[model samples]
Each structure stands twice: as structure tokens, then as C-alpha cells.
Target: MSGERAQPVREQGTEQDADVDADAASTEPEADTDAEPAPVTNGAQSVVRALENAGVEYLFGVQGGAIMPVYDALFDSEMTHVTMAHEQGAAHAADAYGIVTGKPGVCLATSGPGATNLVTGIADADMDSDPLLALAGQVPTDFVGSDAFQETDTTGVTRPVTKQNYFAGDADSVGDLVGEAFALAERGRQGPTLVDLPKDVTQGETDHEPGPARTPDTYRPAERADESAVREAAEAFAASERPVILAGGGVIKAEASEELRRFAIEHEIPVVTTMPGIGAFPEDHDLSMEWAGMHGTGYANLALTMTDCMLAVGTRFDDRLTGGVETFAPDAEIIHVDIDAAEISKNVQADYGLVGDAKAVLDQLYEAVAPTPDADEWRAQCREWKEQYPMTYEAPDDEPLKPQFVVEAVDEATPDDTIVTTGVGQHQMWACQYWEFTEPRTWVSSHGLGAMGYGLPSAIGAKVAAPDREVVCFDGDGSFLMTCQELTVAVREELDITVFVLNNEFIGMVRQWQDGFYEGRHMASEYGWMPQFDTLAEAFGAQGFRIDDYDEVADTVEEALAYDGPSVVDVHVDPAENVYPMVPSGGDNGLFALSEDQL
Candidate 1:
């Protein structure tokens, strides 16, 4: 009755457990031994394998001569690699991917120009508290300090922006350095972490055995809210007549959607989200008022200005959000809660500052404040404002597709959980306005740095993070071309992502300002000579669909979504359509460009 499994255990170990011996004897040694071990690969290959083992399914980067060996290894590995048109695009893609997945996004870049290009994205992620791991390639170690070709001291360049950085001294340290980079990127008050691997280290051979993965010993978890602070905040909320909850990206980062919703409902307090915090509360909720900044909703701005108390969570009161420091919430008593202590009272003065994770803080507040059955008067006021200026777009009977219509159609066609990523431009604004985001971390874009060419590659990263979720990019024609080369990566990886190019043949946002403020001098904004995007997508082995008529938008989007793999909808939108209600740069939120009359 003894099984084949009995032999291996009996032979390998002491005969203490007969059942273990029986099971071990049942299994064949050759079959078990044939299993492939971790590859004894080069530093680059080991780096890629370590990422894969750590559950990093996607890495965004642009290929360069210095990093070609890494790319070769990445190509041969199982981890998904997304090639962006620019290093900035890769970094932004990594940032957005991390935001959506709650994991450290991996971005790769070569030294010198490549490393420099990632600076803005790195700063953006740092400012936003996003988790990102940047793998930068340096010149050969022999060329260090010599300023050889493509050599740059990336560690020095990125020290201020990253949580920590390391310069790989040899091949043996590459795997451990990468693991540390990931750990630092995700630990408390998350930010970008960098690892600069010299070309020699990447190509070098080492006889050292790859050690077992080491988790950080001093991993600092996000702080929980003190009961006393939560009680004070709750008491203030209970007492105020016009209390509002200002939710920010921190809420999304803390995954406090349920807690936020419950807290808002219990207290009958209206919720307002910052641009980056759009989906923190359900957009469909009666109390949800998205974006209360310079370009924010009029009612939300007015509410902030008139409110008695402001319960701020996960957001620093950025100048953009607070219409310059002087005029922002002049009448409100502010209570700021964030994981980062530095963010507390950095801009607008806070009456009470509580440093803690947003979800933990909100949970404590919910417990302290007993649920109010109703706030009919407050709800009515918020509803009235919502009814007055609901986000909308008119289907124009025109020659070219309208950006608003395209955004709305795409939003309607995609599933509720589908993630949307955007580039910076008129198209980014249009996506922000027209799309109804009901879930937190669903909408990802470069808000802090306002970097261009972020959409397509970010969508690629988003798709990689949530392979089961449909990811769509709202890209302007100019922005599309900025990182359009990434379409190849999507095609090659067979990522099922839909890129909706709002083809206006011009940098619409800049063109608008030029037309309105600069005496209509077109200058360098036009892109009429650009390649046909439909043809370009087809060339990349992806299905291409063009929308000429406004009526064809929904159908075109549907077709793109149904396509086997990556697809692009090059809709020729009207170049004249401007992102309106813009607060001119360095202008107050109160001084908005209302319409043609205001202009």
C-alpha cells in the first residue's frame, strides 16, 4: 500500500513521518528535477527576473544604446516591457500604473538624456506621493567621472526627487539594489526610487549566487489617526452648518472610497475632490462635487469660500486647488489629514492637522460622529448647484468630430471599472470634464507636472496593471504623435487597450490661447502634415478605425473595444473646439475665462 512518494522522503530525510514518505515516494525525481530554476543570467536578466518574481508584470522605458542589453534581456524574459516614445512618457506611464494598482511602477531609462528626461515625471510622482521604481542605465564604470559618451551622474541628478537611489558598483549587487528600490518606492509616504546600473555591470558576469529576496527590516506603515484628533474633527463636522469634505489623491492612495462614502453619508456633508482626486467619491453620489480649484465647478468653489469648516483628506491645498493662498477658503476652519507630515499646513493654514492614512483617519471619524439621518437643506443646496451646471456636451452637426462628444461616447461605451489615462492638453481637460468617474484611481494623468505625451504610454501601463480591465487613452493628435511610437509596444505585447486619438491636427490647447490671446497667430501649433493615424495603427499591426461623422463615434468605439488586441480610433475632431472655463496660468480661480464674452 506504500506510495511512490515514500521513497524520496525516506531516502532524503529521517524516517519520522510515514505519511510524508508515502507522498514523496509517489512523485518522480526526474519530473520534479526538470522544473526550470531561476536563470543564472546577466545582471540585466536577473533584474528583470527579480521584478517578475516580485509581481511586477509591466515595465515602461525607451530603448537607448546604453540600455540595449537590458532591453535584450527584457525581451527574452516573461515580464511585459512597454517601449515609450520618450523617457518622460515612460515615467508618467509608470506613475499612473502605480497609482491605479497600488504597486510600485517600474520605469527604465538610459543615462544622460534618458535620465534627464525622467526628471519631471520623477518630481510629479514625488509631489503626489506615488510609488515608482526608476531603473536608469549609466555609462561603463570605467567612464565614471570622465563624462564619457551618454554618461550622467543620475544618482546626483535624482537625489532630490527620489526617496532613495543607488549606483550599482558591480553585477552582484544589481538584484538586491532593484529589490531595495521597489521596497523604498512602496514604503510609507511612497515616492520614486532610482537604481543606476552602469553598462559594465549590466553586461558583466558574477560568480556569486543570487541570494534569497530580502524584505526591508524597517518598513514604516502609514500612520493611523489618533482618537482625540478624530473626535475633534467629528465634533466640528457635527456643529457646522455648511461643512464640506475636501478629498484629495491621498484618499485614492489610501483606498478610502468606502470609508469616504460612509463618512459623507453619515454626516450629511458634501464631498469635493481635487483634480487628481476625481474618483475618490462616487461621481453619481448626490454629495460628490469633483474638482474645486481654479478650473473647478463654480458651486464647489463658492461652497469652499462660504463653508464654516473644511475636512481636508489626502490633499495638500495646492495653489491651483486653492485659488492662490489669499482667497482660498477664507471663511472656512480647515482640518487637514494626510499621511505625510510635510503636507500638513504647507499652503493654507490648517486649524487642526492630523497626520495619518486617509482611510484609518476617516474610519475613526466615522465612529466618533454618530450618523445623521438627513440634511435635507444642505443636500438641496448641493443638488441645486449640480442641476445648474452638470457636465455636458452637445453633439454638433459639423465636419469634424468634437472632442467632448468623443469623450462622452468613450465613457459611455467602456465598463464602469475601465481605467482612463490622459495626456496633458485640451483632450486631457475634455476627458476630465466629460467622463463620469465613479471609482477612485480609475482616472490617471500627469496633474502636478502637466507633462505632455503622457496618455498613450500611461494607457499601456494601466493595461498591464489591470490586464482584465479595459484601459482607454484620451489623446490629442499632437500628444498622440508625441508618444505614438508606443503603439508598437502595445501591438507587440498584444495588450487589449483602446487609444482614442482626438485628431484635431493641432495642439488644440495652445492653439486656443494663440487664437484668443495672441492675435490668432498660429505659429508652431499645427500638425496637418502628420501621418494618418489610422494607417499608422494598422502599420503597427493593430486594428485602426476612423470616425468622420459625429454619429459614428459610439459605433467606432464599440468596434475598437471588440477588436482582438490593441486598437486605435483616429477621430478627426474639430481643431476649433477649445477646452473652455480655463483659469489662465498664474490667475486666480475667481478670475476664470467664462466664455467668448469674458474673452
Candidate 2:
């Protein structure tokens, strides 16, 4: 009785008969085998589809729990995803890619610590005005304010750094939010933008398809300057005798380098580029004075200090470029042209403010001017200054190898179209001074943020953007040590980039500052120990080479450049050598010290 099946407690007893069972089963409904199946769609698929609609082909990010749904969606898409070792590296790679392509480069990270890791790179891109789009995963919607596991307010954290930020509230509208964020990142005065995605939203089902990426209807930017303002600025240019054309990074960003070059040559004005403005005008051109600022060429600095009229375009007039705002172009009446109207008089007051795109404004100004200014005397004087303070360094056979020599050796070995990247330090200065950049986007580095460990990861991104072109990076010993782990990413991707470490066993720039300003008190600047970078490179599966003497520079550089995969060249440089033509913080640019004694 215990093993027998229990019967239902019903009033009627069971009447089991084969005919009754068959008749009852025959009345039951049959499955509709020919009906169409439900469409497969989800919030994650919508996000990926939004990117596809924007023509995004590559993404740099790291996988984690909060962002797993998006990554799972990525598995079915054709877009290539690079799983970077760290979120910071992914951000930097995306930044560099944007710099190279002149478009918004995409990066992704999970919530909390993962999102926080991308802060430095985001700040760098924000400061430099590079186009970038960052996607950050968040905790489920219900757990938003509950101090849930791995939860962080990503939008709040990135609000100040991004041009704009959005919170994805639901599966139905998350894709549109992402599309808007992408569009805003590359809009006028391009900068980084962010979209925070919640796990629940990404995992939820959705049937709505996202439209093409677009900025908000209320967003609009001026693309042309007022005609009256352009004509007035042109009149100022024509009346001045000692005039100089100052090109900034914005010129390159707006693709106005050619327009800048033509304006400078047509008007017969000497050109001086800001550090970020390098390659806006060909350095080989007769009108090119190279660049100006702290540690800039002495001649270029002299020209800027003595200029009577300045046509400054697409520059923020940062403190580094203007050592002492009181003395910067003191005698010159400034005509500042920038896409962002806020930069018109923020740092250096402008006599004429032309707010528009760089190329369009340049063209309008060019049309307004009837004839060029008379500046032959000023041109001759600029040439004289170049001869007086040449950018040259001494390299003796018995002394330690000069970093300048290594830079020149590498530059000579590479092709003219090769791209160069650098980390923040003395090596960065050396690379800026020695290598001649002749094209826009060829020189990419952290300018405003001055972040260390930017070189290697940036090189990885640059290589990916322009695989046909050669990519080289100049990193200091201290800077290289900060992100040397990125070598593994480069090696794994088989990127063809050659990095030269100007190894002096110290934070060379800090040591130079300590010597000059702190009475030679060697603080924590000098490293007590340094690993053999050559062997370290080998461990990362990259080709390694070393140079201890001047004799080994050429061949070692050639060998490194010839390698099909990533390579690192550790060149032991003179520790005692220091960057000259220094304008001490807040000092007068006109009176820059040429040596420590002068300081």
C-alpha cells in the first residue's frame, strides 16, 4: 500500500479505459510547428549594434563580471575586440588610436576598480582634446544605491573629465544613449565621452533597434567665424612688421595643417609651433622656426618673445607654452582663433577673437588680406638666432652615450612617414627636440596631463591604427618602468613597434630640477636598482637590444627597426647631461637659462 501511487481526493473514482483515453487525447491541441520563432534580441546586442551602425571596427577593453553580458554579445559580432591586460592600457591605446585616426576611439571597462583604472587615460585624452568614447559597466539597477558588490558611481567619477556623460536606465533606451555618447565624443571641440551601463539592463531582452549614432538635437557648434572679425584680424596681420604665426594642436585636429602652412608661406611670416603643435608645419620649410615654449628651441623662443604681432590659432596658450603670462608676447597684439570660444581669452587675452573651425577661419583670413606684411628684417633676425643657438649636443667617444645621438640614429634609420610616441620625462624632451616631424598626427604624446607610462600603450594603439606605417616610441628609464608590463600586450598582438629607453638610472627630469632648484639634493628621484630591460624584453617575447656606447647606436637601431615584431632598445645615456634653454616655472620666457649656471 505504501509503494502504490496515491489517487486524487475526488468524488468520482477513476474509470481507465483504452477507448476513453484515446478519445480524450485526440481532442488535445497540437504544437504549431510552422509558426515563426521569436526574434533573438537583448540590451547587449543593441549596444553592439549601435557601435556597428557607427562603423566601429575595433574595441579595446578588459573582461569582468559587470561587463560580461556586453563581452558575450561581442562574441557574435564581427568587430575585433582587444583584451588588454589592464583597463588603463586599454584607455591609453584607445586615446592613441583616436589621435592617429582623427576619430573617436572606443574603450570599455567594468564597474568599480575596473572603471577607476581608466581615469588617468581619460584625463589625458580630456586634457589633450582627443576624441574618445568610454563604456563603463555598472551594478544591477535595483542595487544601484545599496553598496552592492563591485558597485561604483562611474558617471559621477568621470563627469569632470568627459565632455559629457550619460547613465543607461533601461534596456529599451540604453543603445540610443550609447549612440549619443559616441556622437558627442567626436563633435566640435572633440573630447572623451562616457556611458554607464547597468548589468540588469545589458542582460535584459529588447526588440527595439537603435538608430544611427547622433548628437542631441540641442547640441550645435559654430563652424565658421564672423566675416567682420576675420577681416579685422587680417588688417592687424597686414599692418604688423614683426609678426609670427603660432600653430597649436588644434590645427592638426581640425586637419588645417596645410591651410596653416599655406597662410604662413603666403604671408611670409615665420612659424613657431607649440610642443603639441609639432608637425603642423613642415620643419624643413624656410618659414619654420620649429617649436617654442619651456625647453623649446632657443631661436623659436626668441622669435616669440620679440614678436610684435602674433597670429595664434587653435591654442589654449597653456602655462608651459607661456612661461610668464605677463611677458609672453608682451609687445604683440594677439589674434587668437579657436573652435572653442572659451579659449579665446582664458589664458592670454586676444585682441581679435575668431571663433570657428581652424581651416575655415584660416581660409577666411587669407582671403581678407590683400598683401603680405614687410618682415624681411625680422626673418633675417630669426635665421640669425637659429645660427646662434643651434639644437646640438656633444658626444665624445670616451664619455657616456648622448641621448640625442640615439634619437638621431633612430630617426635616420626610420622612414620619413614613421610615427613617433613618447612618455613624460627628459627622453620626451630629447625626442621633441631631436626628431623632425613633417606631417600631422606623426607626433603623439601626453601634453596637458603629462602622464608617465603613456608611451608603450600609445605605441600599441598607434601601430594598430596605422599598421602599414612604422611606429617608434622614446621612453625614459623612470617612465618605462611605470608601464613596462604593456610590452606583453604588444608582444602578444605582434605589433611592429621599436621602443628606445633612454636609461640613465634615474628620473632624469626630476634630477635635473633638483640640481637646478633644490641645491643638488638628490631626493627619491634616483633609482637604487634597475633591471636589465634587454632581458626583460626577451622574457616578454620581444626582441631586445642594448647600446652602451656611441658606436653601437646605429647598428642597434637598425636591428631593432628591422625586427618584424615588437622590439626594445635600452640605450645607456649620460646621466649628467641636462636639457638646456630652460624657462623655470613662472619665469620670463625672454630670459630662459641656457645652462644650470644661468639658472
Candidate 3:
């Protein structure tokens, strides 16, 4: 699931003057209806009402003939629609919007190519458990299997990527289908869901007053943790001398970071996170050992290796975290708490599994158990490890600056509340290791799918949702090139975001692996030619800055942050530099192939 594949290049499209028609209804059902109110018109109009019922403020998409009817409805409605160059950009934006707002971010696309383009972003959301709703305009039911213009099976393509997908056949089904999609997207283990509406369904008249979006009759997310299980888990934690709290993205998804921190503090337990779990607890917390995975901090890995009891919350214990299930936390008795029952003991065997919402379970555990006060010695060892093997890197005294230095500089210049997003690969790993994330919903990335070109579009979405916050996207040269056209979208929307490109001129992470593991042979990892980043940004009407010298980093970052509108900062970094403290694929954290100088 984590294997690399060739990424799709973002396509550039302009409205080619082709057109369509729609039945636009009143935005509201009629404020004061003396006459039998205009029977609420078509399914597209009803769909908008349902979205409002579910509290959707923005719809991200690219306009096309198949989806033109929905766009027509938006003409008279209050809902804001953000236009992107491609459907992929729209879906990525929606994904980030959901991540930041804790709501099912909505996206729309036309049939065929548009829907297919959204597949990767939907897959990214599902892999990361980000809540999202993707709506696609399909061909009419009568034209099924007829090879109609711009026709494709949206449901079939999205089935594997989405949490659930539905094909709405008639106008009457639109409202409830939209509502149900939202509910399924947000409930029990959040993820992306879809409702494919045929063009006929959108244009067809419907008198059925589409009611408010409601939670389904049968589907209800479990909000309460088992009392006995909580008590037992807490007792085990209190009993163990070297208990470590392993928090995953589940903690953030459950909004349980506060409870997690409190539990760790009261019990004097060291805390480590999975890759997607960066912001669950403050990285600077006294008991925090930061992330524990393939590219995790050395001391954090050591903590995982040494722990006697691991109270893991909202984490799936994925391959990256476990390294190899047989050797992972070999000495630790794991107490896994997650909202999804299927995830419990799916990978790593859990001595105790509490299947419920992470926040709910942690709340009960905090109330039920008393911590042992004699964990001072164990706590001291965690602190000692932190001191001995801190995540330290010294910059090279030359041009083409160290990438870590750029991340650190950006972190220092930006406000602590800045929403930082990343495109996958070295920049992402560097940001995770270097940037001190203090708040939840602030660090966003495609951790599961490792999708390139996710940062700029997601940052655009985050900025759209939180207009006042400073959103910085840390992107690699390769990833940036993947969706660079989105900068034009950012400029047109007047989104206040700064995309900092670490120009390494290579597929840096893969090259690093090849160098270390494959006897220094990197065949297809390097890009022989690098794009002129500043020129591209300027062409997109965004302010651009290129910094190659280490001395100018602080000034460049400050200027870029101070810019009034969307901007791009390209910091040319040493192409040969690699992310360190790395555990090779399927290797234990303790068996890291560290840099010779590091060892």
C-alpha cells in the first residue's frame, strides 16, 4: 500500500467554451410563501440545501459540462465555491479543509476524467483517515454502458478509496444521499466518502422537501469506552515501571490530545507518536519523545525499544511504526485503544484492546485510576536519553544550504499558530523532525499515501478555511513541480500562504535509500534538470524568492512571511544531503542505518 508509483502530472485546462443548462431553484425554500412556494426545483438545488444542513461552508471543484447543473445552483446560493485548475487539486484542498476543520470537506467534479482525477486525493484521505465528501456529476441513467460523452463509473472507481460510495440514480435520493455521505465520512474512523449524481438526477425536478442532513438510523459511532477495560488498562499502566504512551493520528482525529497529555503527565509516562500523529501532543512537552517510526528521532526509537508497557491510542500500528511485528516493542505489553474495532490487534498483538473513541477511553481511564508516584527514576531515564541523543544537525558552511536549516528558519520566523503542510518525501520527514508543532490540526501531510503535490493545494484549502492563520507549505522541488499550477489558484483566491520549496533537484528520499541499501546505485531517482521555480511562480502572479546562500535564509524567510499575498520561496538545498536516523524498509527502529558521522 505504501509502495511508490509514478504520480500523475497536474493537467492545465481552460474553459473551452462548451456549455450546458440547469434548473436553478430558490436558494432558500421561500422566506414568506403566500403562493405554493416554487416546489424546491431540482436535485442539484436540494443537494445545496442538504450541504447547508450539514454545515458545509465551501465547495471546492473544477467546473465542467456534466457538473454544470450544480454550478448553476451555486450562482444564486450563498455557498462559496473555489475553482481549481484540476479535480485533483480540488480533492486535495477538500482533504486539508477536513483535516483542519474536523468536518467533511466537500468537493465536486464532472463525470469521467474529473472523477478519475480525484481518485488519488480520495485515496490519500482514506489512507490518512481524513474526513472528506466528493461529489461527481455522472451521465444519465438511460445512457448507462452506452459510452456517452464524458461518461465513467464514479462509484466503481472510488469504491476502494472512499469509506463508502453511492450512485444516486434519481432526483429524490440526492438530499438524503448527501446527508448520509457526510455522516459516514465523519463518524467512527473518519474518511472520504462519495455520492455520484447523474446529470439527469441533478436536472430532474423534485418536490420532496429535502430535510436537514441527519445521522443514519442504524449507523452510530460508539462514544463510550468500556469501563472495565479502562480500569484494567490504567491498572496495567500504573503497575508498569517503564510505561510509554504511543499516540497516533487517532488522538488528533478523536480530539484527545489534551487527555493524552494529562494521562502521560499524571502517570509520568513517556510519550511517542506515529508519523501521522505529530501534533497530538506538543512536541516540546516534558515527557514527549516525539515520533517513533522509520524516520523517527533516535531517542524516541530507543524509548519504544526499552518500554515495558505501551498504552497506544488511536493508532493502527502500521508497518512503518511496527518495523516488523515480531520484534516491535518485544518487551512491552501493549494496551491498544481505538474507535474502529477492526483495527484492534490487526497488526501488533495487543495484550488488552479497548475498542471505543480514544478521547472517551482516555477520559474514563484518567478518572478510574491513580498513578504510581514512584516513577521518578524511570522518567529520569527518558530524560537522559533525550539529552544524550537529541535530534541535532549542523549546517554545512557553503552555498546550496542544508534543507533542515530552511525548515528550522521557517519555524523560527513564522508564528507558532501557523498551519504547516507538506508534500511527501524528504521535506515532509525533515519538517516532522525539525518543526516544533505545538498545536493540533496544525501539521498536515499525506503520511499514508505519500502523495506528491499535496502540499500547495491542501495549504490553499487550510488558508481558505482559516483565513487569519499563517499557512506555510514545505514542498520539495519534485513535488512542487507535480502541482505547481495550483499557485495560480492560490493567487486568484488571494490566499495568504507561502510555499517554501526545498529545491534538491532529485527524488531525494529514494536516492538516499538507493545509496544506503542498493550499493550506491540510483538509477531513476535524480532529475537531470530542475525547473526555474521563481519564474514559474512569477508566471502564476505570485511573489517569488530564490535563496541559495545560508546567510540569506533568515532575511528571505522574513520577507516571504511578510508578503501581502500568496508567495513562493525556493531554497536551493544540497542535493546529496539525506534524511538521517532512518530505519530501512521493514527494519526495526533500533537497527537504523545512521550516517557514519552520526554514529
- Which is the winner by lDDT between candidate 2 and candidate 3? 2
The digit string of per-residue lDDT tens for model 3 on 151-185 reads 99788888988999999878887878898899889
Candidate 3 accuracy as lDDT: 0.85
Instruction: List where candidate 3 sits over 4 angstroms from the true fold.
Output: 1-39, 596-599
lDDT of 1 at 163: 86
User: lDDT for every model?
Assistant: 0.79, 0.89, 0.85
Ranking by lDDT: 2, 3, 1
Q: Count clashing residue pairs in model 3.
A: 0
TM-score of 2: 0.93
TM per candidate: 0.86, 0.93, 0.93
Clashing pairs in 1: 4-25, 4-26, 5-23, 5-24, 5-25, 5-26, 6-21, 6-22, 6-25, 7-25
Q: What are the RMSDs of all candidates, in order?
A: 8.4, 13.2, 7.0
Worst 10 residues of 3 by lDDT: 1-10
Clash pairs detected, candidate 3: none
Q: Give the Å error, residue 224, model 1.
A: 1.3
Best by lDDT: 2
The true-versus-predicted C-alpha distance at residue 218 of model 2, in Å, is 1.5
